[model samples]
Target: MTHAPTPAAMATRKPARTAPAWDRHTWEEALLAATLPHHGARLLGWGLAHLAPTSGQFRAGTSRDAGYLGQALRLSAKQLHMGFSQLERAGLLARAGAAATDGPRHVLAQAFTLTLPSATAAARTESDG
Candidate 1:
């Protein structure tokens, strides 16, 4: 016969699991510092924070939707747009969207992809030199 766990034993159980914190690579931080505006940097940070711990991709409902991201980051729509534009111009972000086909009213809906530089180039340079 099996016995039930005691209250003391249950109390000693491990705590609930949580997602690990996101850490920026040194190259990524340097790129952001050199190219992006302050607001753009903040937006990038928020995006990184919302990304999946293992995949480093933004979660659904947060991908490519500026309005949703703006609300989550507590920034205004205009600020979000500006930040997006800056990030895009810096070669750090890629966005794709289709024009609204229904009505004359245009809807801004797009998806973002973060581009990270690979370390292979640096390694190759070191080997050559």
Candidate 2:
């Protein structure tokens, strides 16, 4: 059996290296921004910026549906809906349901959560590239 290394020996050894933190959000957004139109990227940016870490998912703070979001973002409700659909198809957003409120029947606002890439997934993507 071999004895443990001396403190001086350990001190001279190099420290372990770790993978860098995932920082591809802007890159991912840029790709989508180029593909989406009619303020789709703006809507996506708004949702992403408002995400709050909870449990295992990033939940959006705004629970308002398309109409309210449209008014706030200055885009038509139909335009907001189109943006939502595009982002959902791209796997960036997930709709849970409409917000709970005694509001208009015609309103179709949706509560949604953002799907962010995990560190492990980012590493995998890096390796694959």
- Go through the candidates in order and give the C-alpha RMSD of each one to the true structure: 10.2, 8.9
Predicted candidate 1 versus true structure: per-residue lDDT over 8-127, tens digit per residue: 999999989996443446435735444344555556455643543444444334544555555666766666655555544554545555323333111134344554434543343234
In model 2, the runs with Cα more than 4 Å from the true position are: 1-34, 51-63, 97-110, 117-129
Candidate 1 error regions (>4 Å): 1-31, 38-41, 52-65, 97-108, 117-129
Q: What tens-digit string does per-residue lDDT give for candidate 2 at 1-129?
A: 999999999999998898444334653564354334445544644654443334213444345545555666676655555665554544455567643243432234444555554554444434533
Lowest summed lDDT across 10 adjacent residues in model 2 is found at 99-108
Question: Local distance difference test, per candidate?
Answer: 0.49, 0.50
Question: Worst ten-residue run, lDDT, model 1?
Answer: 99-108
Tell me the TM-score of each prediction against the true structure: 0.45, 0.43
lDDT of 1 at 102: 31
